[model samples]
Target: MTPEDLAPDVLTDAAAPIDPARVSDSLDHENTLKKDFVRRVRDCLEAGESDTVYDLVEPLHPADVADLFELLDADERPLLAKAISDLMGSEVFAELNDHVRELLVESLPAGTVADIAEQLDTDDAVAMLEDLDEHDQLAVLAEMEPEDRAAIETALSYPEESAGRLMSRDCVAVPEHMSVGDLIDFLREGHDLANEFWEVFIVDARHHPLGTCQLSWILRTPRHIALTDVMKRDQTLIPVLMDQEEVALRFQKYALISAAVIDEDGRLVGQITVDDVVHIIQEEAGEDVLLLSGAGEGDINEPIRESYLARVRWLIANLLTACLASFVIANFEGTIAKMVALATLMPIVAGIGGNAGTQTLAVTVRALATNQLTASNAWRAVRRELGIAVLNGATVAVVIGIAVSLIFGIPRLGAVIALAMLANIVIAGLAGVLVPLTLNRLKADPAISSSIFVTMTTDSMGFLVFLGLASISGLVG
Candidate 1:
């Protein structure tokens, strides 16, 4: 009946809930540990207590160390990096955001940078080195071992952001003729292979990958069975020159844990793992979002000068577009003067249309990104959008029409505004979908300038429709 007696029964029940207060306390304790760890390290640095900082940071995971680096100020990052120089391993480098890693690499001596690169896999080493300045890159490359340097140089030669750069050269590969017993002996004989792999690729005499043998099959299959017998032939083989985004799509489409990377000669050169594809997916997804806003790689760690350079051009382009809308408004100055209400009500129509256009534009851009919208389905998508636009126009027209009539006590004015709203909304929807699609056809990035053109269309059309209708209907004195 007591708490101690109930503890045994609670432990036996798998689904028993823990105390809410206890759970909260545990979370708070973990958070406190993180904060205290950071503070103690900071205090150690300030007080010239080097050993204390080193001891405090020693137990943290690489990812947590990376987080701690980010939590520090710009001035503190270098200090922490210097303090935990030994602890700054390949895993910590892998966890860092690109901008932060670039900054850290730039700050470190070239020799020190090379030392870190040597400890990393080929893919991670290439990632760390590629962002450096040409001179710094050369200096670091000079310090690397001859073979490691050659492998990185070969990967770099294949083009930036390609599968060649993304793939690691370390992988378990076997000749297709090997039996399961032979494969197991090969694995057991302490071959220098990747630290982790989900599958072993079976290659032909010319080093061309023929098929794959999953680890599960290797473990369960009879030892006398040939690898060719158990291997799955329908494996995805990525071309070394393929874009990283395309590589990620292949992984996603095929649901693969690992895929072979083949060179021009169809020879297996490397392998792309799921972990690498996960990073590519995240990078590509974020890159698309930033590109949509005309913001290039909008990382918080980006240098102020670089951030300004990236964003200012977009702002300037927006300014030019705004002037075009202003010019359209100026042409209707006479109409605005004749009816003050025209000036007041005109903005509502244009503003609503711009918003509606942005909504459709965003959807279109996303569709293009995910490969859901292709030339084959373009017309069908456009038609679907047009139909939705018509429905939206009708629904909005009725509400705005009735409201305007009641507010102004002028049925004719209400009717004119309502028709204008309906027309603008329909145009907004059409322009939204068409502009991005057209840009995509022209081989331009659909997200980059779609918003600017879509806004221009909605604004110009909204103004022209409202003013022309008011002038034609004799609403303007």
Candidate 2:
């Protein structure tokens, strides 16, 4: 549904309305949900006034409530959940952060979690259950209805992050034999159909998707018109095993509001809507940025041990790469000692190169993720980066050259460092583009590996070039 569809202060009649200003402030800023509100809720919970806690939360949108849950401490969640058990619904669960949701689910009984699963769509239900331990998963599944359990089981069997795990089973599908009138009547009469859908799928006898009929078309067309006459035969179908990122790209490329997800046999099993893909896009964008920094998952709700393990391994890897720069500096130890200026000026070279490399790395990784860069245009991408580097290097060299001459009172020393600066910047740009491209070619995650190699390349080269230039130019002596 669109943003215009929702009421600002309240969701339903049963939900006690909250101040619109509270929602407005929360929506406008990164963390506008004030501590005072949280403290008030805590006080209510502490005093065993569950009704007060419920009264405060009942009016907010499910998304807002989800945000509120994030603002609360982990210990406060169960208390809040207990205070508003009836008010908590599928919408709130669907809007929850994955890590936070998992914690809450773990705290609840298998049956309670199963009941929440039942309230969500098949894909969301699978998402909520798939993270639990296998034993716990079985227990939760056993507590679910046979139909819901079966759907979740099948989705879990597909690889994680695949379209099968991302698509909702709650879609309306009709045989092409039906007319508009028949389709409309079925939709009005069917009790088990999805409550929220933008369009309906038209299928053939084999249950393979043949076309799609948007809700608008159904309303506009005459009742006697056959489904095929109104349906758009051209549709983007997602393979069940296709990665969710690719699925989201397809949705964007086609401007599709919804698409059918099919199994290997070409029978439609589920559907992916724009709303589901929006979450995937946001998650992937954020996940990649965090991975680039070696910050695992970057979720506050992640277990401490898991966060430690994720970061420590990358730190160990970084230590090894840092040694490469140390090795370069070690070879020039005598030169540096003889001319203290060489030691003083060298860090500037490495620091600038590292920053340049990072700039290029960010752009290249983003291009690759967006499908803007690939084998076909990789050479062009490299050439474009090189041109940018040359310009950037020339600009940086002039500024540093003048500064060094004024600071050190040596024009030749300035020239020597200037040349080194230009060379290192060029190398930085090359490393930034090449490293990620190489990782991508090797079937590794470019975002995860690119930064380390790029940083190492820039650092090692930065030291090597600057020291070598000073030694060769005899400016240090």
Best by TM-score: 2
- Name the regions of candidate 1 deviating beyond 4 angstroms: 1-40
Off by over 4 Å in 2: 1-32
The stretch of ten residues in a row with the least summed lDDT in candidate 2 is 2-11
Q: Report the error of model 2 at residue 245, Å.
A: 0.8
TM-score of each: 0.91, 0.94
The RMSD of every model to the true structure, in order and in angstroms, is: 9.2, 5.1
In the range 139-217, model 1's lDDT, one tens digit per residue, is 9899889989999999989899999999999888889889999998889886577778889999999999999998999
Q: In candidate 2, what are the lDDT values of residues 1-477, reduced to their tens digit? A: 221211122222254557887556435456445677778888998898988888777657887788888888887888887777776677888889888998877777776677778889998898888898899899999999999999999999999999999999999999999999999999999999997999999999999999999999999999999999889999899999999999988988889889999999999999999999999999899989998999999988788999999999999989999998999999999998988988888889999999999999999999999899999999999999999999999999999999999998999988988898999999999999999999999999899978999998999999999988888887756
Predict model 2's lDDT versus the native.
0.88
- In angstroms, give how far residue 39 of model 1 lies from its true place: 4.7
Global lDDT of each model? 0.83, 0.88
What is the lDDT for 116 in model 2? 77
Top candidate when judged by lDDT against the true structure: 2
> Candidate 1: worst 10 consecutive residues by lDDT?
5-14
